[model samples]
Target: MAYSLVAEIWSELAFGMLVFALRFFTRWKYSGFRGMSYDDLFAVFAVTFWILETVSLYTCSAYGNNINLSVESALAVPDSEVPRLILGSKLAYCAWIFYILGIWTLKGVLLCLYNRLTMGLQQQRFVWVMMVVSVLTFLASLLWHILSCYPTYRAWQIKPYPGESCTQRKWNYVIICVLDVVTDIGMMAIPIPMLLRASLTVRRKVSLVLLFGSGIFVMICAVLRAYYSLVLIDDNTVALGWAAREFLVAAIVVNAPSIKPIFSDFKKRLTENYASGSWKSGTGSNAMSSGLPPYNGKNDIENNTAITSGNHKRTQAYKMSSIGRSQPKSESQDHINTATDADNDSTNSNIGKDGIIVTTEFKVSRR
Candidate 1:
């Protein structure tokens, strides 16, 4: 059971890290190093603490005391094993701290995204409210674990049998679980009204809502973890496994919107490759006789068109003009890439009132 649990934990962590890498690469590719934002930093902090939590989790599962042990069983534990138990207990405590930090840091990442997405809009108000709620909830959970366990050391104490409050940590789990779900709901709520009002098709709006609402799965994980922790109060390994699962779900959900670009790019490349292959197959004999490169439609367009903004004086109006995009209410990779292209073409093109021709990216850095 332990080996299988460990395998599940590590496999989930590897997948989470892959999505995280794509998120980071997407930001770096479009925005560059200078474009690194608070969300990026928060993502770094989140992954750091999650990795630490996993290390502590492995140690606890390997050596920690079983919460199911009765007072008699605890007392009967040999002195030789007491040291290992104590180390496990301490690490378990640290694991909880790491888990708290890692998950809450992910909240910070989402809030940063909301802050940027809602800039100059009425939805900014909700973002502020949710940010305050997030900070309060984070502090509440952190303090509960720190102070709820009387004398601190009692949390890990085995001899004399520390009470279930210190050992099982049911109440602490409840508090964190409730707050975790609440904050997730609040974050999901922020972008929804805006998306509904967005000038997009029903299908597009629904897709965007579903994307942000992916946090619902994370909330479900938190609830299940809490439910089982209270019911299976004796199983330390069960609780730890749930912790890892919740973290994995939260990491993927929060990073989903950020990594959409990767899927989009992959789809585009696949289409191009298929089209190129079809073109090559059709012109097999003629192309071989000419000994020239295959006729690619995409290359033909790129080579034929030179996007030049004739010597028309650049106007500040283009810079000042309000810009909007048909996308989820967040700073997406597509928008970022389009904006980067606009920046590169700043010297070459003069965008007039019809700003639709050129996309301008507005980044709100405030957290």
Candidate 2:
């Protein structure tokens, strides 16, 4: 058995699964219906296919991989183990298909994310076109692989029957591998045009591009896999390692951006909680001396809408010499004015007592 194949699958999935979990958690934190969006749906699809690939790989391991035996020698293996070997071959076929599915779904996931980030109608149209083309190419590649050998089972069968010979052409797969690279490049380029026009600072735009940079590495993997696809056509046993790496790399690329918000959220909460904890309890020298009000167990929040407009008369009633005080016309006037004055006074008083949040703005009057 080739232990290296299993090890490859193990390493890639470990990192992929960690980011997958983070993506799910961040989506849930931001929205209740995480799976409702197309992006999340694609994530679910990719994850399902990846899990199936792992199962298929484990089943393939039951038989000896890279046994290094001649056809005669392989056929000579004990009848009991021959079935295991054939079974493993079939599992490899299934795992290969799962790898394709996982990569395709991830491409969709990336496109959907880019679609959300872009603003122009025309840009969105281009994204939709790319998405459609990507799906078509994947389907074409899948069809080619499945139907490459007549009766499909021959695609993974150990040998030809007494009369019927199975197709074992490696060149047929080269097309798929080449198209894989092209589509990956296409997916990577779809958002660059819009990203270049973003109003954000250079640092943010660079980070955004770097977020999509994983695709470039994935393209490199596809090139390697292309070479291995030929190797696979010559002999299928040599491909488990290559396919494993391709699947993992594509996985990490699609998932890399979705997990960043989780890190930022964690950092923000930790800093705010630490700062709040630093404020000591009590009034006067204990708390007010530091300019931070003492925190009462019950801290009621004041919303922005409750703030008095700049037009509201100042709470302190100072009678100017030019405007002598006049008597109120009625009890109602006195009642309303007095209540208004009282509320405004209370807000100013709470500046020191409940000054938990402060918002400032600058304005230049047209007059």
What TM-scores do the predictions have? Answer: 0.78, 0.67
Compose the digit string of candidate 2's lDDT tens values, residues 25-76: 7666544352236888899999899989877876776564322334555455
Candidate 1: Cα lDDT at 70: 65
lDDT tens digits by residue: candidate 1, 1-367: 3357788778888988988998998776645676678999999999999899998988888886636556898889988888898888888899999999999999999888878777667778888999899999999999999999889998788887887777888898789999888899888898776777665567976987898889899999999999987888777767888999999989998888787765766776687666633221111000011112222322111112111133432322211112333322124322211233344366225444332233222333311
Give candidate 1's TM-score.
Answer: 0.78
lDDT of 1: 0.72
For each predicted model, how many residue pairs clash, with residues at least 3 apart or on different chains? 0, 0
List the global CA lDDT of all models: 0.72, 0.59
Off by over 4 Å in 1: 1-3, 273-322, 326-367
Q: Which candidate is the best by TM-score?
A: 1
At residue 276, candidate 1 shows an lDDT of: 33
Off by over 4 Å in 2: 1-3, 34-36, 64-81, 159-169, 228-238, 269-367
